[model samples]
Target: MKITLDRVNENFHFKLKNERGHIVDVDSRAEFGGSDLGASPMELVLMGVAGCSAIDMISILKKQRQEITSFRAEVEGERVQVGEAKPFKDIHIVFYLEGPINEDKAVRAAQLSFEKYCSVSKTLEPTATIHYKVVLNNKSL
Candidate 1:
């Protein structure tokens, strides 16, 4: 896929456009002259991972005939440096599943999704240590 980034100002503010023509604004604290309404590139990458895994887990659970009342994914990451060459050293995803879900099945689904299905997880595997946990109805799965 292709994406375009246009400068919004002399600072780090920019507008990003994807192949589908969707546009998003991105700016840094130094560029935006503030701390609100913008996501750093690193934050966006973590979001991508969360989104990818959430989608896959939900789909897998649904196909398995699990009654899901609620689902949430919490993603956290650690940065190793401050330059363009810097990378996220580690990432963690906590999948919370509610409503009559099987713990073993949920955990297996998450593991399979990260290991073989989620594109973002697969792509980041080479760069960072990706860890995950599954919680079903407030209990560790």
Candidate 2:
């Protein structure tokens, strides 16, 4: 559960590597004197929430024998000024699932993820309010 970061340039650009050797490029926005080369740290936090929840939901569905065709999630966060830094005040996620899945199961899976399963959301729960909605086969559930 360790990672490393190396400067990619003189500015705020960096390359992050997980213990498994996976790489994620990181950088600040152009307005922050970065090269706009990769996702910012805050952006990665949102991505982490999305990815963590997606994995939980998918695992739940798979165990329930649901046939999933595709899945995608869109995450948005609102930031509030906290001293000299801006932190997320609220985070919203929209999960789009395509499959011959049961609607009730999908909804329950999402509920379980936010309320119990997703660790990333839980980590941010104390500071940020997290909300999510599920859309299954173009229908909101």
Candidate 3:
């Protein structure tokens, strides 16, 4: 996989394109002299983790014959400032699942995604403590 980033101006505004020709705009916030055109690089990392695990959980649940009505994930991260390197200290994903899906199965699907299937989660596991919670039918489990 290849990605190229080019500066759109003299500042941090940039256009990123992948090998598949997929493109996204990336820039810093207004305080950083950027126009806030798109997501920051650090923010993108969190998005990747969320997207990857969400896909994994859905796939696993579907295979298990789960009758999911609606699914949503709320992901958040905390970045620690240490020296010149700032990295995520922790990441949390809360899954809101609705339908006839059981709490146990929903939890297991999330576990399987974070622990076994999600590449993004595995990649960040060494640097970040990944935590997850499951809520089924408007009830937190």
Candidate 4:
């Protein structure tokens, strides 16, 4: 599990490649002289948290024998204005799951992710508090 970054421009733009040779374009925000090329590093980090936990939830629910028709996550990171290092103060992840899924199972899956399964969220725990919610069939659980 290793990745490398190759500078693509004089500015903050760069190409990130994983060990599998998968590519992800990364760039700083325009305010930092980036050309709006790709996602800012912070944005990608937050996205990683979302993706990691979502995968965990899906796996957990599937093992619980729940049928999942559609699922998406909305993740938000609140960062503190620290000079040159604006780390997130907290992160909130909301999962929208549509299917014949049991509400309790859905909630439990999310809980399992935040409490034990999601590695990315656990990594950020020291620097940021993580919050989670599950919405099933348009109702918050």
| lDDT for 100 (candidate 1) | 91
lDDT of candidate 3 over 1-141, digit per residue (tens): 789988898878899999998989999999978899999999999899989988998898899899999989898999999899899999988989999986788999998998899999899988899988999998999
Between prediction 1 and prediction 3, which has the larger lDDT?
A: 3
Please report the TM-score between candidate 1 and the true structure: 0.88
CA RMSD of all predictions: 2.3, 0.7, 1.1, 1.0
**lDDT measured at residue 39 in model 3 versus the true structure, 0 to 100:** 97
TM-score of each: 0.88, 0.98, 0.94, 0.96
Q: What would the per-residue lDDT of candidate 4 be over residues 1-141, giving only the tens digit for each residue? A: 898999999998999999989999999888889988989988998999999988999999999899999999998999998887889998988899999999999999998898998899889999899988899989999
For model 1, what is the error of residue 99's alpha carbon versus the real structure, in angstroms, after optimal superposition?
1.3
Q: Which stretches of candidate 1 lie over 4 Å from their true place?
A: 31-36, 82-84
Candidate 2 backbone clash number: 0
Segments in model 4 whose C-alpha atoms lie over 4 Å from true places: none
What order do you get sorting by lDDT, best first? 2, 4, 3, 1
Write down the lDDT that model 4 would get.
0.92
Q: Best-fitting candidate, measured by TM-score? A: 2
How much does candidate 4 score in TM-score? Answer: 0.96
lDDT of 1 by residue, 78-139 (tens): 87875757798899889888999888889988988988899988898887999999989999
TM-score of model 2 relative to the true fold? Answer: 0.98
